[model samples]
Target: MENTHGYIPSALLAGGIAGTSVDVALFPLDTVKTRLQSAQGFWKAGGFHGIYSGLGSAALGSAPTAALFFLTYESVKHFAGSETHWSPVVHMCAASSGEVGACLIRVPVEVVKQRAQANRYMSSLQVLKNTVAAEGFSGLYRGYISTVIREIPFSFIQFPVWEYLKKTWSEYQKSEVEPWQSSVCGAIAGCTAAGITTPLDVAKTRIMLAEKDSLLSRGSIRYALTVVHKEKGVRGFFSGILPRMMWISIGGAIFLGVYDKVKKTVSKYYLKKHDHIT
Candidate 1:
């Protein structure tokens, strides 16, 4: 087995491929989850159809974001291993760095996707144009603060938890476990994290997508929290906690498992070629 503590460019390459592929495959579900999170009466509007609108925008947004996240994460992990210690703190820091890098690029795309999902009638381009015209370039980053808040903890928990679970599971297996097992563990970790962070996500989504005249007009984090508290109290902030957890768990599992498997496969192939050359 390859040492988990060494630099591995092949893993980063593989992780990128896996992450992008999984995002493309599972984006429709993500669109559904986001709609459910953002909408006030998501179920009453049109049931699943209402919730799953604008999947196309989600697909576009998720692909690049997932790719960058996995690439940055794997690369960071490899580089961090060069240090003397590989403690939990190191892992957390590495994961945070990766998440921050991914989110920087992802925030604009998320705005576009959220806008499209929030308004079923609008296309991706229409959302972009309207946002640019009204709010200018800054408008594209509507919920950046919330995004960062959500991601830092989310990534910090996600990476190390997944690594721990994968390692533990591998030890129990008679042979190398399949990718599906890793995916399952990833899903569990994702669900746990999503549940813990649901309130923050709700606040962020509302702030980003609120109308100009609404009480959330300023798009400030404080404004968003106040709106939710007034409208639905503290419970209001966790509106779609159940569904969000379910979807995130599933999505997380598939995403992480695919990333690990792809990276492992690529590394294996590359190593074999190098060995033959030597």
Candidate 2:
């Protein structure tokens, strides 16, 4: 197998493809999950209709966000030097870095997308326009801190689990894992991470969807949790857990699976071309 570590082109292309595939394929589920977690009731969030409300924003952002994430992730892992003893730590650090980079693009896209999904605006363009007009460009990043908080932990759990599962399976099989196997591992890891991080996700959604002058819009993670707890008790923390888990599980399979497949393909092609040149 080719050592695809730190392969910038492969990482960028694969991550972009994977991100677009997962987001586009499972967008409706994401909309459902977002609406479910909205302070606005589901029906008020335009439930069961316009499920693709924010497709434009999501589609535009997915490629860059995912590309930047995998680029950072692979580069970190490559430079860190792979050792079984330090694999989990390496993976966690890499994933955390990846999330931070990805969130630079992701938070703005999410701000527009979620508002559109919640029917607070007519379109992604309208959301962008109104947000910038009223709250300035920074408004597009209203939930930046909350998003990074949610994403870092999710990646912390998911990436290590995914790598461990792949390593174990590869060892058992006496070979590198196939894309499908990687996908299965990703699904399992994603489900676990999604369940554990649902509350953070809910808080992020509320913070992003809050009015500019509202308390939640101030982006206090503590305050967001307090409000949700006040509104729905313990259950509030787990709002949209089912859909979140479902979406991530399925999305993880496709995302990591496709990423492995594309990366492997591109890496092999490069190797072959180099061999021919030599």
Output the number of the lDDT-best candidate: 2
lDDT of 2 at 63: 94
Judging by TM-score against the true structure, name the best candidate. 2
TM-scores of the models, in the order given: 0.86, 0.98
lDDT (Cα, 0-100) at 90 in candidate 2:
98
**In candidate 1, which residue pairs clash?**
187-253
Model 1 misplaced stretches (Cα beyond 4 Å): 1-13, 43-47, 50-52, 82-85, 174-177, 213-219
- TM-score of model number 2: 0.98
Write model 2 residue lDDT over 140-204, tens digit each, in one string.
98989999999999999999999999999999999999999999999999999999999999999
Q: How far is 179's C-alpha from truth in model 1 (Å)?
A: 1.5
